[model samples]
Target: MRSIKFNIIVLLTILSLTTFAQTKVVSNSYSFGIILKIEKFAGRDFRYSLELKSTDTDSLKNIVIKVQQVINDDEWLDVNLAKDVTKDTVWHSLKISSKINPRAKEIWLYANFEGNGNFFVDNLKFEIKTESGDWEKFPIKNADFENNENNPLKDFRTNANIPDGSTIGLRNRTDSIGGKALLIKTTKASVIFKTNYGANKRIGKYCNINGIKIYYETYGTGEPLLLLHGNGQSIVDFNKQIPELARYYRVIAVDTRAQGKSIDNDSSKLSYDIFASDMKALLDSLNLKKVNVLGWSDGGNTGLIMAIKYPDYVGKLVVMGANLNPTENAVEKSMLNQLKKDLKKLQQKQDTESKQMTRLLLMLSTEPNINVEDLHTISAKTLVLAGEKDVIKAEHTRLIASNISGSQLIIFKKQTHMVPNENPLLFNETVLNFLKQEDVKN
Candidate 1:
């Protein structure tokens, strides 16, 4: 009986060690690439291998694996792997090995396609070198594309834009090796693919504040400009604004506590006040005295609080879709009702993470009891922005603008709260114009 049990344990361990774990990439546009979120794999020697097939009858020169590491603020170490691929529908075993920079602030691993074709990938394996020099397998969930989820490509993230006349999408199909494979199909349209904006490792770092680790990234140089994203969002939400803003000022994009890469350890409730305090501590850690702040939604609420309570830390302030209170008078009834329903569902889950999310929803439903008159106390140069059809009532937005002395207001006509992302060019220009204009002399 004991021998049988031991054999069973050994078999289970062997099966675990042999499981295939890898990512999939598909290209239907001019370029397609998969960015591996491999922070834990950094500073280690690793190998990635996969079975690949293509329908294109040309040489496979367009397919390559790229390893990029940041050497400094302006330099990088970029290497291409798997150089001997050929055009074939048969299974080709492709593998690459490299060392990740131990001191790099950012690193990227990409499986890229730079042509038009139907590409299939399956049975991918990722391995890391152990201390004793043997390779150990690292398991990626749904790596085999056999998961019975609604979306077979649930774990993969694609580029946001698919150009006109381009047919870029994912499908699960029978493959030669495994029973199923991920097919990336693209045609006609030319689209350029690059690294994810906020997912860059070279510029991301952590700071200890309020007993939690806060994640942030820095770009460009000049007067400090701080960026804050909405609830359940990270620095990625500011992707449209960062590059342009970086050209003029030092951009500090942060992932708020309990969101993005930031981790919260305390069980205390979350509030705009706490978020504002976290920003203060983060600024102190960076030795920043004052900064320009751009915030959206929940971020906007936090920025308003910071201006009210810690005015000394604010140089100029811009907030979109912020509300003084969590009431129907301030927020739209439909949105508020939906949030309450979500809070109820979260409360029923009763798990640790769910409870934390419940707290977030609870805060949104009943907190931020700011007096409209408090806007009068903010001392920083302020710009209040919102969409004409914003979730926040038009009257509430105007009330906020009217209470703040010398503050400017702009409501984008026929737009929604997502104007920043929907019309980034216009949003960026409007923000820059406001930030750059000289103050009027009395």
Candidate 2:
């Protein structure tokens, strides 16, 4: 009986220690922020700038600070926030030039820390550019962090619920600029800013393609360049490439049928051929004679079909992480297995959403059965790309490129199928270089 009682005590002690460890980890992770009221300067073009300093320069690599100019409760403006702060133990000036909404009622700022770090911020300044080409300071309360005399954290706010001690905290401290500064400290936490890409009315538009509406966004104006996203994704997937590509070409980013804002009510099974047909119809509606095409994954398959069936519509083609078939010879066995498992689960459900998902999965598993010899029919100058670790087999990608006469193939090293999203700068550069090349007449 004594031995059993000792064992129970040891088990209880171990559980207690485990609980304490978990609490300690949770306490170390938190997020904090502050809201500054600035409503007087609505409907004006202005430049927002701030000075920030970090104790550890390495930690700055993971910290995120987002500034939003809120307009009338729901409307908001995203400022191209400062991301070049690469210095430590010294102040760095971050500036952004953007126009404010005419109906803006308030502006808020939030800072998120990914790991244990401390940062100091001061001199939050906003300057409006006058019509006469002059800069004037807008009236802002506590523009500098030197007003908190009685309260060390008068205008500050944090997630720290404790009155005295917490993982996340705010306080006033003296800085090298000979003034008080707001000190924000956090142990660890994560915060992601929700971005609206597929639904941005600023650039989004729709055109009737067949019986369904196809949503697309256009930017810049040199030559039309169509961007097609992967399966189950929309314009949001190409958000990183659109703006940069827009600088050089007329970027036309489209939401494939049944995805994003292009809602489909038809109960038919999805196929790359149907998707390619929709693309051709969309280009026709836009009055585009011939345009360059950039496609990812499933979009790549659609592009291939478009080039095969409607060669006159495609000029230069770039396809990344695409495959000719749905079998293990094209895609990794593990990916095929996972897709089959997911499709099985979705098939058991009867909801509208589940049915839609089932269709997408079915298409991924059994469609795009392109014959390698069919690629020989493609006359468009093509650049085939895939990541070294992509779900699509490397040899399959090479086979597609080899079959297409005079095509170029590149495999991104140390990258997966998500290279376009994971390292967009490199991906965009490679794409731009290829697209800007002098075309050889077929």
Q: Which one is best on lDDT? A: 2
Question: For all candidates, what are the clash counts?
Answer: 5, 0
* Tens digit per residue, CA lDDT, model 1, 380-401: 8899999998898888888988
RMSD of candidate 1 to the true fold? 14.8
Cand. 1 TM to true fold? 0.61
Off by over 4 Å in 2: 1-111, 114-195
Instruction: Candidate 1: give the clashing pairs.
Output: 28-186, 105-201, 105-202, 106-201, 106-202
Q: TM-score each candidate.
A: 0.61, 0.60
Best-matching candidate per TM-score: 1
